[model samples]
Target chain A: MSKYLITIGLETHVQLKTNTKMFCGCSLKFGEEPNTNVCPVCLGYPGALPVMNREAVKLTVMSGLMLGCEISRLSTFDRKNYFYPDMSKDYQISQQARPLCLGGGVTIQTPAGPKRVRINHIHLEEDAAKINHYARFSGVDFNRCGTPLMEIVSEPDLSSPDEALAYVQALKQILVYAGVSDCNLEEGNLRCDVNISVRPEGQEQLGTRAEIKNMNTFKGIYAALEYEIARQLATVARGGVIVQETRRWEPDLGETQSMRSKENAHDYRYFPEPDLVPVALASEQIAAWKALLPELPSARRERMVAEYGIPEYDAGVLADAKENADFFEAAVRLCSPGLGKTVSNWFMTEVMRQLSVTGKTISECPLTPAALAELVELVDKRVINGPTAKELSAELFENGGMPGVLVAKRGLGQVSDSGALEGFVEQAIAANAKSVEDYRAGKKAAAGFLVGQVMKLSKGKADPQRVGILVAEKLARLA
Target chain B: MSHTLDVAYVAELARLELSPDEKRTFQLQLETIVNYVEKIGELDLAGIEPTLHGQALVNVFREDVVVPSLDRECVLANAPERNGFEFKLPKIVEDA
Candidate 1:
């Protein structure tokens, strides 16, 4: 492995976000009863015609646009022949000679930083039904049949697991943000097949690559690559050339095992699907739709960082989740971008924490962006201290309505009156003689405990930074 | 192009069980398919927009949901084994 360069390629199958199965009117819900959400076209009953699903196509084109692919003015579906129990039609309707989208790239952030992976093409196809195995006999569920699938294939540009992972993550992120697919791997909405081969450190020619299939998770992809690297290294040490074959990623074993010799497309006898006509997208139509795509997450992240002056890290965290980005934008427009960062901190740390505990999405939170904006405004204007504001934000997330109303209802308004704060500070000092002594002795950090005592005495309504400064000045006089 | 893709080789890679007679039949059929594909080669497609889907179709939809489903029963419904829903088959090893 040290002397050889591992070359990797990926084939990602993303299920489109559509209401019905690809060629049928059956609901695309994962469960309804085995074979329940299926009809003639999906079941491959004789003479049944497949009316092209426009939503699937639109989603595909949008995905293509997001990936920077050139849409093919003329694209068509073909029939891939096979005989599997799960294949109700004994063939898969797919694109072979021509596909919907071609030549795109994804830039991913790796330990080595951002690297772009070149995509060869993206094609549309139908998923096969599940082959249910039994001890006595085997049955099939056609519910998954004709489920819309878009296969995104990358060029042999990825050189390592890190690059491959970054590529997959970036591509998956784009697809998700495009609202093209949910990309839930366990549900098999997004599955990946990896092709790996090793070339001697300076060799110009490529090595024969093996295909690893059935990897259903990002973790599975990482483990599969690690195993392939080790396995290939051992083969090289033994002076044995690695064979090109298809392998199954045994996620539990964290290794890849040989499945079958990898085959090329000729094996499936790909031919233009005779039952369906070639789909020609009008230039004007695609042009109009292309103009409708929203600014992608990456661009939005950059905008938040550049225009809003929010920290890049915070912006990235907010933009990473679509809903969070929406909330951040809505809240940021109401207050200063600096306030967005602070509010983002509360949202990420406290709001998300509570959401995790209560199992709620940001959309499900009772705290509206307008209310969050209001709370942030109060804090930015020094109407409340950070702690009190955080408390109010949490209450707002748990409860409902405007922050100002709720703050009053909870009696948690911050106390900034210098005289009252001075009295509280005096009481706290009298009670904490040791801490006061420590503060006078130049133990600067001891002020925190004293400040905490004062805030506790004030019901946490005192502005913390203000209290800190007041306590430090008082301790200096005592010194 | 030095990278000649032999039809038979690709078929083997694809795990096809084509018979000898079928290979000859496919040889002709496949050649025709490739020839028709050459039409794409004819156009000076430089900067021409590609259509992802035909414009005539629309509104393909599925309800947003996760309906409760079978775990092993659906998997083993027609399986040819009883070893707790696993499909039992004749053991074949390729070490020979």
Candidate 2:
């Protein structure tokens, strides 16, 4: 029912795109042989010390600046004691008392309007090893161990599944634009944990919250929230109390099962890590990192709408991805004056379809911006008709070539010459005498069939609008 | 104020299987250590900055450079169990 309100928050972990591990000099590449990237520091061997990677710290600060967070001048790492096979030391080095960034938010556009979800903190930590399970035994890949990871914890400001999805999307766009992380959910680069609770309408106090973890895709996050919200609402409707617990989202089952209760929660004895020293950033360093922040996604979207005169919705769609927005701008720069909307339409429809089919991003598209601009120019100048341009676009999408060269090679130039069009129109009329009789007998729509025949005869090289006019003239003379 | 330490809980968190006598001895020893360290609270000095570590160093970071990683065989040599260049463990029933 609409009377009950759903609340959601997210804890997203992104693996920073760095050259080496956080505390060691091991390569941070993916899909390498198991344990190939392991080192003494990352493997947590006794007497081995850790030296913090400067690039990881710089990236964290840059990300904080982009998100409008307050970069803490003094931050330190702490040891979170736990027993897990993923970590060789049985303890994780994390930011417990103080994190790198604090108090930022992301703005998401919902159907109702735009809403801002507040973020609690973003802390820098190291990732654990990946575990692969089999029927009888398990294997551990230490390649991912000690990879620089940033955890972004947001305030419970989301209300619906759509809002949660928009929040994540917005965050990913900003991160990618700022060059912080790739935000790739497939290779486990980005992971999210959804915290959800529901309360009756007009309630000030919150209900018990359950956290759903290990969601690797945005679609799974949306579905998990939807299912959990309904389950919670039904429990409340049936006079049952919600329990505080951690749930595992079984994507195959489309349901969540309780993984751990409140009693089993680990009381991680957090203390300052002695091996690593404190990080004290100067004011000049903070200001320098802030200066490197680029124009974020939302601002770029608004500017695209205002400067290019495209519709707000179109700008929003284009600016949702960094590469898509960059491609649009590059193409628009080469377009003629007042053709921004034309370029946007081509990108949204034809270009997007091609991208989906080829499984390539806009950056990887074979057709360069100049090529697309030339095609649009050809259509505008009537050098090629609409159908010819459409056909050439598919050809260009498959094999990279100049549109003009392709048109010249294929003889797809539109025949707008009066003599050539008149000859085709006469042939069409002579072949379709019955349609001509139908038109003279007041079946006015029969002329459309004649026009179609003329196009077929011309092999779609004739200008369609000119064919219509020529057909009309020939038909009147016959009558 | 006095603090208490739950040795069983601590041992469980550390993934250690301790005997009952060892647990009792650890509880007493941890309490004594805490009591000994609590003596610093008796000082009345104010405006003292809390030291993060014993050393007075800050901003010790290495440059972003690529270095050689350990050999795969050498890295896996320290594992208690191995299976085809990977660390093998008992079947982990938990799903990711």
Candidate 3:
């Protein structure tokens, strides 16, 4: 590594999944016909007033609580004045000074252990319209305008690109666990802007920083930071100072290019939005929202390991998605005690493999958790042997049904009774006379072949272990 | 007293082309408005918080239910140029 310390901060914007726009009643749907969701308020028509959506505020506060943020008692909206076609109103409504949350941090796992990346604040804002560029002219679609967005600002505490990735992933997990936003980067539900600065190993003050804007993918963010950091280090080494400017990440070119200098930046004249009133939250209300906070992914992972007796790796996989974790818990609750690991094993191997093949999530699976529990119980109780249960599980996964009922319906129960299995064992001994002679002549492996014959003769219903014991008894009596 | 504010810069921000005469006229007018607003600083209001809005209400919110949007034709009727269903503008080449 070079003798330079790189500090990075992130400004992540997440779109809330609300029914309507932030300040209007237009539905927030993606991939619809252009300009179809426009209204007077969203279109920025004159004399049209905006009404604050209560759901948006609740979601933002819920997200803040999940991240351990201190909820603000009083928050207000401000208009950031700019002349961009993305926003037809010429000023976008955002929070400048007093945001909805303050002083939260996400704890990310690092090589040194878990480190908490500090958050400056999270503010509510309205998304701009979609500008589609063409060869001749641009097309403006106002459908996405005024959608509720939250800007999560982090402190420049990240030391490496990996740390930044971990912080973002952890933050996304918390938000997804809280049901705040979809956090789908491809759908533009979540986006990030990175601020990076580099200084010599022992410098006191920070070097001039450069910002890369609108990075939507984790790979793109990592690559952009790597490229930008190297570029800055090279400049410093060549006796050239880094310039503070805004840059764009070109994924096709695999580099970041300067967009504008600090001098060319727009001075957003912020003023309190006159249309919407200030939101003064009550202490009781804040307490209620906090109570509604769901168990975070990290906490749930720890609990899964302690309560379910699963390995850390297994717990992490289960807790990655709330739906999967819920399915696991539900299945375990219905199962017999001390079978949590068994249930997780089934999930990690067969269930996951089936889900991937079918391209369906646990929530969308036809085989319910109760059914999975029953299947595992059947195997545990020896009602069905391992291979029989495997076959039955595949069937159950395709067309969901109770394992016991299906076994009974299909006459697939294991033949474990000695009296019931003795006939098959005798038949195997008589049919495999050569193997029996070999067994008598000290070929101990002949017993396995005899058991396989018994299994085939019994149509795979006989438990191989029971057949093995019966075959040994008959063979010893014959000897 | 001479005006300290640059009227030209303000005009540029507002996207208005102002002649020198118009600039001088607006400069003096803006100064009067600023001076009038500055008189509020004379009051003994060290403990008072700055007002966020003219109204005294707070926590005014609307439910999150979505209503019908305006018809697409009506929504695009006011556009100076229309590209099928969207509003068309002059070609904007992004800065490299």
- By lDDT, who's the top model here? 3
Which runs of model 2 end up more than 4 angstroms from their true locations? A1-5, A199-203, A230-241, A260-265, A473-479, B5-12, B15-36, B43-45
**Candidate 2 C-alpha lDDT tens digits along B10-94:** 7776668999999989999999999999888899759997899879999999987778988888887778998788899999765
Query: What are the per-residue Cα lDDT tens digits for candidate 2 across A336-371?
Result: 888899999988999889999999997776888888
Across residues A428-478, which tens digit of lDDT does each residue of candidate 3 receive?
A: 888889998999899999999999988988888888888888888888999
DockQ of each: 0.09, 0.63, 0.70
Q: Which candidate leads the pack in DockQ?
A: 3
Q: Is the docking of candidate 3 incorrect, acceptable, medium or high quality?
A: medium
Q: Tell me the lDDT of candidate 3.
A: 0.90
Order of models, best lDDT first = 3, 2, 1
Clashes of each: 27, 0, 0
Model 3 residue A289 CA deviation in Å: 1.0
Please state what fraction of the native interface contacts candidate 2 reproduces. 0.81
**Model 1: per-residue Cα lDDT over A208-293, one tens digit each:** 88888878889889889989988988888888988878788877877788864323433676766766777678899799879868
User: Once model 1 is optimally superposed onto the true structure by TM-score, how far is the C-alpha of residue A396 displaced, in angstroms?
Assistant: 2.8
Ranking by TM-score: 3, 2, 1
User: What count of clashes does model 2 give?
Assistant: 0
The TM-scores of all predictions, comma-separated, are 0.81, 0.90, 0.94
Q: What are the lDDT scores of the predictions, listed in order?
A: 0.79, 0.89, 0.90
On TM-score, the leading prediction is 3
Candidate 2: RMSD to truth: 3.0
